[model samples]
Target chain A: MSLERIKIAPEMYEIMPPEYQDLVKNATYGNENRGWKDIGTSKELIEEHSLCAGCPESMAFRYILASLPAPEDTVMVGSTGCTSLVFPHVGIHNIHSLFGNQNAIATGLKRALTVRFPGRIKDVVVLAGDGATVDIGLDMTLQAWFRQEKFTTICFDNELYANTGGQESGLMQKGFVAKMAPVGKTFEKVRLPEIARESGCHYVVNCTVSKPNLIEKVIKNAIHIAREIGPTYLQLYTPCILEIGKNSMEGLQEMRDSEKPTERFAYREYISDQAKELLTEMAAKEKERKAEAKRQLASVKA
Target chain B: MSTSYQVLRGPEHFLPPAAASMGIRLPDPGQGHIHGKIVSEEEAMEAAARQFLSAKVPTIFPGPLVLWAWNEKAAHKATAVRHLYETLKASVTSTQQAMLIPMPDYRPKYPKINPEVEINPNHPNLTIWHNKIDACMFVGVHCHQANLSLKIIRGGTDCYTIAMCAQAGHEDAMLSFRDATAEKIMRLADWVKKLKGSVEPPK
Candidate 1:
């Protein structure tokens, strides 16, 4: 018998609890495969999970997962592609459903759990790949949002069916090239958040994985809104690492260096502020229209 | 000549007789406590690590850590396992031990768009083989260390172990395992390496 005692640093032990030390021991003994970087982050309070390492959107989802409250009651419905890969590694309770059926399954789960357990369950989150949400599951998603189902739906918009070897998805940007769309995708990318808003979803937000902090905040807020108000749609910009011709390291760096900064500046300096202003203007117009319609109805009745 | 192992036939092929063996009754399932509290980041880390340790077996020696981030509400654990494998460069470890044990078969009961049905029209054998592959992939990730060897009975598959290893800067184990399984022992030995700084996304 070979006896090898490894001594961990005092600082490391201070940062992590005894349970975590046991987890590392189990991992060593089990020979389980996982991304080293992600496993490292698992030591943090928030843990992110995903299907594809190459997809930027998957990485973004991971970042968002890192920011959420631990012992989360949220259930993630992963459609096919990158987001599907996150489930096993994250160590959270999750469901891997068929492609494009995340919304329907999530809707059923939310209804069932809420009905059975009542207020015990917190929220249901659907993590969809571009192909599943945009191409196949679009109809179900629309119905779910239109019905105002109580759930938080996140679309990691990577512009392709990454797991099936980078095929073009309905959400593929105009200039993007995928396996099926070798030359370029002719269809315009679907602005899913705007569609959700029009479909009568109570809340909608679009952000990229690049902004880890913001993504976390948005996820927390989205879950809250889903529970308090109704359904919430979050369109996340996730990059594809392999499909986009980059390795995992480069993909993460790209998200951190460019995606996060750009998103922060845009949301803080322009989008959110402008959105508030626009909402105010829209509310005034709606009031005027409603009053006019009431008067017209009254006059006709008279 | 009849097989010499006739005495060990039928359902009792492997297990010892209950009357003659140590019969320990497991605790009732639903009777267990259900503590549903939101864990802090620190607590979550500790819990993940502890769970990892409890689930691990030492037979394989330095198995890859399988981290599962389950979304509790969906009741869909299989998809989560698949997603974990894809993102992490991990494979499902199906073993015979898992088969003998009463593990939950979390495969979706509903109809899915089976790729094999559409891709191969003429070749029945090919379609069946492909379907088996798909089914295996779906159920494989949930297989624990003991069940890993069962995956090999089907042929042309690997039985990998799953554990949850969370430490500062130990993220490279996945890549290290991919590069060299032989180096896994050394990697585990070096688990004490501290993360250089905070794990913040780049600005």
Candidate 2:
């Protein structure tokens, strides 16, 4: 995933497709300030997604990919769902092995990467849908967190099995009438954030894709914490427009509606004392590094 | 796979070729060559057609792109795949379930297509061995997934692999078809139909 590895041969540049050229020129391979605002302006690591138009999951995917602190050294493990549909289009290396086993795979992958590159930072992330995270893969997902695996787990909680035709999922709201819940859901949505916090995650966040800056901050914080401390989880409310019978343009409104301060999906965060200390140290170090770089640039200009 | 770079100290740092374990070593990444020699699209399709018609157990391993959201021509490609399947009477063992369910609700809608068997994307070689598949073609699979699947099939079985992709062809596949458009897939089906008409089925 190093930038040196992605360099193209000079002779092959003329024959390479424009997309490849764009990737080499404009990709945020080594950019320091990676964020969601770079979506349209930069040639993103994701070439293009195959997800439905105006899908909040897609937006979250874009934000997450953009907010990765080190795209050159990140390996994402995704499970089956609407999220898998877009994995093929992402430029970074990703694995979509089995249904609901993303966390288990990421656990192993993170450990293996640690052993393989002791000096380098290789961040492993698990990205999946609500069904994969809270239902079928719950055991493995919780196991990874309990083990304190050094990686980030982000659930694109669409509330139902939207990829499998809108079946009621564990993350679905109580009384929601979905395919498997013809008489309305019998149980309340699973409290995964609280479970993750208790299960040993150093950092936890519950939010939505309605705000890109918040998404960037949480994702970056989660990755940073996971790299130094322990496991981190982010549960994003990405509503399924198709399953909810909302038009393509209404996904954002649905997300905004669900993320009201009093609503279940409202923004929340839990950080351990160790994680807090590490973040404060990291912030001060980053500021010092920026100041040093500024001083060096001024000297060159002088 | 972990990459280890060697630096040559000089006026300018010279970085040697990537040394990565468990990664495909592409001699020339831009060139079509990988596991086998690069061949033209027509040549690759011709070989694929011949293999399907002549093999005792020929299988079409359709990926999600055939029936799902690959691109605008995914529906057309699926139709061509169906025609090719009918012409060769090949058994279908799809890897679409690697990341998806093969139920009626999750099935492709344009022209409903179904596989004879669904194999896990991670261990496709198991299906190849169990079914005694001699020749298989990967249609509409993602490049990265196809690369891993091809290596697995190559490692454990003697099945000849073909990669039919819309992007640059895979280097791991024995026969690779690049820029595999809907019309090209139909042409391959037509070629297989002609070849099948001229030959007797293998027992």
Candidate 3:
């Protein structure tokens, strides 16, 4: 037997996936010394999938994947459009599903995993575009939430059917000229997070991939909360560089100023009764902890 | 961390999914069209390569597919497609290299290559000149890019399209090759460049 002394990064392994050492790491969620305790070592899991430059969907995808505590225990159900373009090439177990059926497929897969490998599946996420999430599969998505199925649903709202030459979708922002909506979409934009909350999701957030860290922190926390609670929903306003017709990064920046832009990473967490109770308990414990520290200091001084 | 969002401020729950379709048909309706074609890998490569090798004014359409399949991870690409153009430009005769057309969004990764041409969907009568091309080679793009090549095919340009995808039959692209990697794409780029200036047409 031959033995070789190869160096190992125990700290990096403790923080992130060991194989992700070569990636450009960001201090998003944790590592106070480096940054915060560290949310799963900011690594790009989606390798070699071409969308566009400064593509917000790609940014969100990387952050979401990095948030997972155990990627091997995760399975994703992805729907059609630009989102589907890259699913086949992802490193994790993924299903390149039909349009408007991301949630349905996710539900079925989760149920199957539950039956076959009980308590084995930790995460079952549905990543879909607005065309699928709002116009096409909205019913299936709502029903899945209503059923209280334990999963996280993220809607990458680029506001139009981007992959098919900028057609108007139900989720599109008003006044955008497109192939299908020449004059502009007349109907108002639908509020997805509100619907998800009403449909029984325990954690519903309306955020964007504008700031990498906020989205990363929100997604990481949302996933953890969704596992402990019921269904969780996030409407991440990721931008489409192609639709914007600008350089991808510059386009994302343009969103920050547009009359009705899309690059905003806004996080709204809806707490449930159970979560509220837990928070209350935590608050009480924290108070006692502070009081105990004060008394100990006083006694030592005396 | 706070970032700017310029749309409606709050999340709203409004219209139900398919309010009218609920009575008549399934909520989520598909086109009932799932396209699947099985072309032998050798056959696809032969047809695509032959057309690419023989053309007088061959047009190269490098889509997100090429970026997805071929771009080296730490290379100097404005997009993932920069290297393919650089490789092609490096290998081919300068006159031959000038005819390549990249999607408008993709910029050149390296210094040289007759500046990349951007194709727009809404251009007036693109089909007129689209008819003039001898062959269209598609690398790592989806239906949108293929649709442009299809225009040339529709123009009675007998030459077929050569599409390189992550997998075969994923879309309507006529030629499909599965498992395309950066190395494979680079090899293909080199081959296309080397084959570009050859004087004789293939038998």
Candidate 4:
């Protein structure tokens, strides 16, 4: 009759496309069996859906789901965009909201689950677009991080608005020709990764779609951290293939070679270090305070 | 029975539906007014022109020209705005201008006008550029970016105001004309061409 007894994670292989099943079979994050070298794996997820062929968004979406700490224990929140279009089609329980609300919804869900399941973990991930998180959803996204909510936000950064026929998003970099700025966009890219770090997110990663192996591995570690760490944001640099001209598998390599080193943003690991230091400092301070109180009590008794 | 597929599932296979975690985030009160007298299309363009002219300091272009416009209505309208900004040289007029969104295809066509700023406000170029503007115009800017731009300008020591959404809400203009139709936006373009019409590139 225990709540713990009732929980069961989904059978990921049955629902996932065959390509991922083969990919994840040997993949293990933070382990020696770094399944990246399994070159025989197919590029696409092999799902029957509306997303463009070689869509970077779809590729990252599949990899994140496959890398979950426990797929059966997962509840996905999809925002209104291309990701939402495919969320229901995937074999799992997912909640959909209008653009910009995915993180907000995921935060509330995590709080409720925490109280209900106590210390047990059920993965809650916000699968959304760059426009949703960096543009329309920025406020909600920042607030979620501000509160240190325990959840994972895997943002598919296709650079601009892809689902709506290619408009410039806040994520748009300068001098890029978009539907609105056909001549070219005049502004620079929003430093979303820096914002994630500044807003107190527990784990922040900025990587591209070219490396599914890296994407898979990062997500797996992020999921593990989310159970205890406050919040995690995985920004996958996926460009809309139709507009950008490269397939999803090679999106990273095809992306701006000049900007790669800067965009990669080697993992900060700031939150992990801070958390350890805070716990140690707080424990020491509490022990001393308690000891001082006990000494006062002994003196009074004497 | 020896199972051909060594299927192993995590204990969370039986988790409940996602309904347990859903909620909404409503916007806080906006300081910039959304409702007022719906000015005439002509009047809206006139106001937009006045805003463009009012820039005491060179205008700051905090951009995001969304390449994906939703419907026929949005598509044509966004194109019109693009045409107008190019005529205006909004980037060159900027004390600071941003680099392209890092998508190579989007960059090659447009001429480079200013040094690029990283997306974050803390970027030194962004801070320096944002600080100098006495007034800022949010042409083709989205809400998230509008908010960030507002935050940066507010932090500046000088008096600053938003020359909002290119149209200043003229009757025919989309609440903010930056996202509207060509004929509708042509009104502003006409006004700019007429007024700043005689002005030449800054030396």
Candidate 5:
């Protein structure tokens, strides 16, 4: 987003809301090096969200928004769920089409954007709930990958439909009792990251929001691969605290417990040859950029 | 008396104040109501039809979902929305593209859906009030955008607003119809047609 787009006219500055002014003056929209570390330090892309107080999805939104490599040129597509509640608060451009059609919308949007801005990188990212990704819109999601749509798809796998009274979702684990699954889910959890690999996603990662640094890396990798290679996917296990019978503060601990090395949500990533090469080159460039910046800082100090 | 709609409430105690601080338009959060009321599909449709018949100028803002359903019901849904507008003699307008980012030639024209032109959500109330529209219906809009737009309208103008959603109805709309299938929209069209037949059409 262009900072100029959000700038309030000087004549109307006193009339504008303070929070909006704060957003315009302090938001980290175009910072290349911004990450999860800027969560509370700077004005975030998401001014605020309406998610449950301790919802991990809320935290995931902040991390992902903060970690976007090109916030100025990125467009987010969201589906109907708790995630939708927060998109209005997000400062970046976003599309909330029909539920479960996020991937399809992103496919067209990415193509349109590419045509509109030739030779420029305009990232299209799809952020949806587990139900939208794995259950309701699974066919479209998979089809988008099969078609090799150049975009990133991130699923906030909260197990059940938390926004809709905790209904049973395909991402819900086996033998987990939910609203529809009164006797517990009878089937195994769908291995979406592996399916993403098989469905032609160039980069795939399965993890939780347990570590901010890892989340930042995963999001950047997914976006970078999709921009140059093909579709990429990130599955983040953002558990629903209320559904899991946990209180507000237990959300982070729940994610941490689920993502232990030996546990179900262990951090996993699969990178294709092209993606690996691209990442390596990009990493070297990033290192060089940092070193140069540090040298400039030291020279100034001297 | 039995209520036709369920009032949504946050599970946590602090969500109300916290959501408020985040600029969230709390719609009937089960304590003190902030925005509009949640009504049933029939109630919402009836209110919309009545508003259309009585208003000096009525408008229909069809969202993308109204143009196309997940099940490829776009043609039929568009037809029904068209029939509703034709029956009520309402002007039609919509947000051209779902994305809010400003771009040149950005508003992709969807004249097929009968919207002569599109308006941006950022200045929703100004466009509505400028057009002198007294009542408007939002059909097939994504819920979040619909919620934001509805709140902006409520806050700025006195235009009666109705939201017809495919999923659960929006609480922020003055009237909201949930499970908005093509047949349901056709039903609303018929109801409006019947109402228009009984009353003098708006000038």
Candidate 6:
């Protein structure tokens, strides 16, 4: 096909599977800015605190926090990036620390809270930039994974340092050039999911902000794993409009389109359901094994 | 077998007295089982000053190495060490080993201008733009500089000779060190610089 003919039309929603398109349409329709409905039980807890509504990162995070099942007494640890803006807005409690320190701080917080509250707080969610996690923060992030700290790290991989004027981050895909790499980037793109897996994170998820359903599923899974398995790493494909050279609307669209291939198969929902089933089975197996062990021990004693 | 070490005061001293604050605590120097004597803050300051005056080249580690550059006055070695240690500890894993070195007083040597060379005042999203710029500059400078050092070290005459001559006809061996160093430096620097000037910076 000719390049001109291949151009995507503005009105033509890309041809996705019928069921997938319907799901997208429904999800978008449901997102009617009913800010209150999205605000889960944590609304009351964070209502009194001054919201960091100014920054987009914070806005996105607040949106997610609102949707979470248990956001009560949750302490947020933000790195030295745009996400810190949410600290002021949430009003309840937060920490603004050094660059790439969010994961470590969140790890510590998760450990402390889980011990103190003992199943009261759900998970300590760390919001950081791709630069923080994949690059400078990699060691800390990897360490948290190895330690299996009970926390969820959400890396807002905008691919560039949005807070710092679109600098390329470790998460930036190959073939992309940044100001620092005017000559061109030399290192291969760092794949966060692969790295997280290598770092021993029991659950690692990659999703984009455009796929709210998928993002939500991944986030929910991460939270569940943080409660059950330990620490979970989630790399979120957050597009930086200013850095990624896309207008706000276009950026949002790109993010949405990025998920098209994966969404076609309803990957998020399928994975979530599968995980739930697997966990249930595992638990049953564990109980049976324990019972068998006890029976053998009693028999030996007799 | 007494190895001398200096104590640096890290940025943890500046952490707000809030529950959420990531505080700094000294890992019992004994934890690593290194038989080195931990020096006091004053001794560390003196040693750092000497190292700075001697023009000793500071080495960069593989992962993130926290360095304290005094923006205004000459930062004490102890202060820089403490900052680097706390920052590293708070950021990296306790198990992940990194060289925590105190930054020599660069302020007195190089006048501190806003290191950010590029700014986007007219960005459609002002808030996002400013934040991106700040983060890029902060991490970009260190990452870029570290990469540069690695490249120079690997591409140095001795390294080239060892690869090219010692391992004759081994193109892979000859190029490995130089290529890896160059790749790391260029990649990190490109990311930083792009964030500084790009119209649509990465999120």
Report the lDDT tens digits of candidate 6 across residue range B99-176: 222211111111122212211111111222222211111111232332232223223211110110101111111111
- How many angstroms is residue A90 displaced in model 5 relative to the true structure, after the best TM-score fit? 1.0
Give candidate 2 regions above 4 Å deviation: A297-302, B1-203
Off by over 4 Å in 5: A1-4, B1-203
In model 6, which runs have C-alpha deviations exceeding 4 angstroms? A1-59, A262-302, B1-203
> Model 3 reaches what TM-score against the true structure?
0.49
Tens digits of per-residue lDDT for model 5, A114-208 = 99989778999999999999999999999999999999999999899988898889899999998656899899999899999999999999999
Each model's iRMS: 17.8, 16.5, 16.8, 20.4, 18.4, 25.3
Model 3 per-residue lDDT tens digits across residues B84-111: 5455445444344224454322222122
Off by over 4 Å in 3: A1-43, A258-267, A277-302, B1-203
Better of 1 and 3 by DockQ: 1
Question: Which is the winner by DockQ between candidate 2 and candidate 5?
Answer: 2
Return the TM-score for each candidate structure.
0.48, 0.63, 0.49, 0.46, 0.62, 0.44
Candidate 2 chain B worst ten-residue window by lDDT:
B96-105
Residue pair clashes in candidate 5: A1-A72
Q: On residues A1-302, what C-alpha lDDT tens digit does candidate 2 reach at each position?
A: 67665654342343334655688789889888878889999999774677888898888888889999999899999999998888866778888959989999998899999999999999999999988999999999999998999999999999999977889999999999976568989889999999999999999999989999999999999999999999999999999898888999999999899889999888999999999999999899999999999999999999
Worst lDDT 10-window in candidate 6 chain A: A1-10
Q: How do the residues B1-203 of candidate 4 rate in per-residue lDDT, one tens digit apiece?
A: 12122111111123311211222111122212211222344554565555555444434333333222334544554556455555455523453221121110111111121223222322212433544443334444555444443444334333233323532221111123333345755566677667763443333
How close is candidate 5 at the interface, in terms of C-alpha RMSD after superposing the true interface residues? 18.4
Rank all candidate structures by their TM-score, best first, as comma-separated numbers. Answer: 2, 5, 3, 1, 4, 6
DockQ of 6: 0.01
* Cand. 4 TM to true fold: 0.46
List clashing residue pairs in candidate 2. none
What is the DockQ score, from 0 to 1, of model 1? 0.03
